[model samples]
Target: MDEVAGAIADPVRREILVLLRDSRLSAGEIAGRFEISRPAVSRHLRVLRECGLVRDEVVGRQRFYLLDPAPLADLAGWLGALLRPSGWEHHLDALETEVHRTRRERRADRREENTA
Candidate 1:
């Protein structure tokens, strides 16, 4: 779980996962989308592979990467268990909605005050 979290904590790795979610891609293809070097992208791929979030296959001379998704499922299950038992997630969601509403109301009030 720690490894999975660590792998996904990086924005670049998350984007990589998004890219691979739809289709498999070669290392060069993945690297092409970013400004980073091929080696840097390879390192991100390595971390994802280590965390079981991605898998690579050697086809011909190039390596292709695809999302495994099992580890993410496991993480989701773990988080669901933690959130459901305590009911904290429900409370958090409610609080978030309330905060958004309050912010919107404040903005409206300020606009009216300025117009007046």
Candidate 2:
């Protein structure tokens, strides 16, 4: 997962991932979209493959890279936890404190009325 995160940290690599998301593309096609040299693009692809974020297949002498979302799914699940309510445990604790405060105030009010 560390490798996956590191591989996607680059904007160029992220774009490459997006490019391969819906369709498989040869190394050349991927390089054509960027102004960088083919070797640089190839390096990015190699990192992505090593991270298990993408898979390459040799199709008719052409290496086609395809996105494999399994590794990303782990990251997504981790990020999803951050956005979820369970992530906001402190907020829930605050709400619970407020509820208890309100209940104590109500109880005190009733006791004063009964005493009067």
Candidate 3:
């Protein structure tokens, strides 16, 4: 998981993963999409490969890379859990609304008493 996190920490590597998400691309194809040098793209690809986020296959002398989302599942699940609202959230929101309503009612009562 650490390796996966580190691998995606780079913007270049993240872009590479996005490029490979829907379709496999040869090293040259992937490199061509970026303004950086082919070697630089290759280095990013190496990090992704090491992290199991991508898999490369040799076909007709061209190495093609594709996304392997299995490793990301754990990270995604963790993030989802963090983003999900806790059970207390609804209760807290309700309590806040009730407090505001009670304050408004008390202010109204005070106004009525003062008017009387």
Candidate 4:
């Protein structure tokens, strides 16, 4: 999971994943889409391949890469669990909101009292 997380932390790698999501592309084909050097893109592809985010196959002279989202399942579940709010969190948020509202009301009352 850590390796997958670190692999996708790079914007270039993430973009490569997006490109692969549609269809497999040869290394040269993928490199051509980027302004960076082919070697740089290859490095990013290597990272993705190592992390299991992508799988590559050799066909004749070209090596094609495609997305492999299986590793992302665990990461997605972990993120979902983290983002889910606990019951106490909801209560605490309501309490904090009420406290702020009370303070605002007291201030308004004080201003009115002073004017009167």
Candidate 5:
């Protein structure tokens, strides 16, 4: 996970992953999409590859890169557990609403007592 975080920490690397998400692209093709040098793009690809976020294939002389979804799926699974609504959330919300309602009722009673 730390490796994945480090790989995605760079904006350029994140963009590279986005480019590779839908289609495989050669390094030259990726480098062309950015203003940065091909060497720079290669470095980003290396980080992504090392972290298992991307995979590369050498077809003839050209090296193609594509997104590897397994790591992202693992990330999603972790996040889903954290984000899924717990049954207690509804009860907590109801409790909060009841507390506010009780406060309002007390204030109204105090106002009526003062007037009387």
Candidate 6:
């Protein structure tokens, strides 16, 4: 759990995981999406790999990264177990949904204000 926690502690690594959740990507491709250097991205990938959140395979000369969701499931299970206090999960879910809806409404209001 230490590795999983460590891997998820970084926002950049989380974004990388989200990207790889859809499909595999090369180190260069991942680096291209950020302002950080290639070596920095490589280091982030290394941490992710060590945590078992991601797996890298060397095909020819390039390294490609793939997401491993099993660790995520483990993490979620642990968190769920820890947060089972008086049905807090449902409250949290409702809070999240409301926050997202509020954000969408704010964006729409901003767009309308801008257009007028």
What stretches of model 3 exceed 4 Å from their correct place? 90-116
- Report the candidate with higher lDDT, 2 versus 6: 2
Candidate order (lDDT): 4, 1, 2, 3, 6, 5
Q: Write the per-residue lDDT of candidate 1 for residues 28-82, one digit (tens) a residue.
A: 9999999999899999999999999999999999889999999988789888887
lDDT assessment of candidate 2: 0.93
- Per-model TM-score on C-alpha atoms: 0.69, 0.73, 0.75, 0.74, 0.71, 0.70
* Model 5 per-residue lDDT tens digits across residues 5-115: 777889999999889888999999999999999899999999899889999999999999989978877677877889976889978988999999999999999999999
Please write out the lDDT profile of model 6 over residues 1-116, one tens digit for every residue.
87898889999999999999999999999999999998999999999998889999999998899999888887898898887756677799889999999999999999999999
Better of 5 and 6 by lDDT: 6
| Per-residue alpha-carbon lDDT of candidate 3 for residues 18-116, written as tens digits (9 for 90 to 100) | 999899999999999999999899889989998899999999888999999999988989889999778899789889999999999999999999999
lDDT of 1: 0.93
- lDDT agreement with native, every candidate: 0.93, 0.93, 0.92, 0.95, 0.90, 0.92
Q: Count the backbone clashes (under 3 Å) in each candidate.
A: 0, 0, 0, 0, 0, 0
> For model 3, what is the alpha-carbon lDDT of residue 56?
96
| Sequence-dependent TM-score of model 6 | 0.70
Error of 5 at 48 (Å): 0.5
Top-lDDT structure, candidate number: 4
Model 6 CA deviation exceeding 4 Å by range: 85-116
Worst 10 residues of 2 by lDDT: 81-90
Candidate 5 deviant stretches above 4 angstroms:
90-116
Superposition error at 53 for model 6 (Å): 0.7
Task: For residue 5, give model 4's deviation from the true position in Å.
Answer: 0.7
